[model samples]
Target: MKALLTKLAFPILNALEKSEGSYEYSPSHRTILKVMGFLFMVISAVGLYFSMKIEQWAGLFPVILFAGIGILCWIVAFLGSDKAVSKLWRNRNE
Candidate 1:
């Protein structure tokens, strides 16, 4: 049982390592990112829905906190977006 489990796990580990080495974004990965982005948008919408439902939009803290989370998620998405790493950093001339 132990040997079979190890055999199954080894391929997953190797694939993870190979994925980490890739520079160009794969199509499937892009699709996944799109799905994640949609999910986050929905999450923000839900937060707004709750704020409105509770009728606490007039409060300063609630307005700031929920909207602030949505804004933060957008900022993080922009900063951490997938892109090809530039080769200029490497000493290619050497």
Candidate 2:
């Protein structure tokens, strides 16, 4: 189960890791997460609106998935951004 989850999350984790390297300076992980969460929420809202307008239930899947991921990001930001940032820095310095 853990391995399955890790496999599922690998893409997100890799993206976050790569983002750290792409920046010339380290970013505040909390801020980054918050901004990303906000953007995702906006996308979710738009997607949902369009789906409803079209009356297609299938469109809700992606919107719900993005919303769930966005909420998870926000939770991580609030609970562990410091730890995450430290890990990123440590990895970069190694």
- Alpha carbon lDDT of each predicted model: 0.44, 0.66
Q: In candidate 2, what are the lDDT values of residues 1-94, reduced to their tens digit?
A: 6566546666655555554432222456567777888899899999999999999999999999999878767654644434454453353443
Models 1 onward score TM values of 0.39, 0.60
* Distance from true location, Cα of 21 in model 2, Å: 19
Q: What value of lDDT does candidate 2 attain over all alpha carbons? A: 0.66
lDDT of 1 by residue, 20-87 (tens): 33355444554544456566566656766776888767554554565555443333233333431111
Q: Residue 3 error for model 2, in Å?
A: 29
Could you list the CA RMSD of all candidates, in the order they appear?
13.9, 6.7
Clash number for every model?
0, 0
The runs of at least 3 residues in candidate 1 whose Cα sits more than 4 Å from the true structure, single-residue gaps closed, are 1-22, 58-94
Model 2: weakest 10-residue lDDT segment is 17-26
Which ranges in model 2 have alpha carbons more than 4 Å from their true place? Answer: 1-27, 85-94
Best by TM-score: 2
Pairs in steric clash, model 2: none
lDDT score for residue 82 of model 1: 43
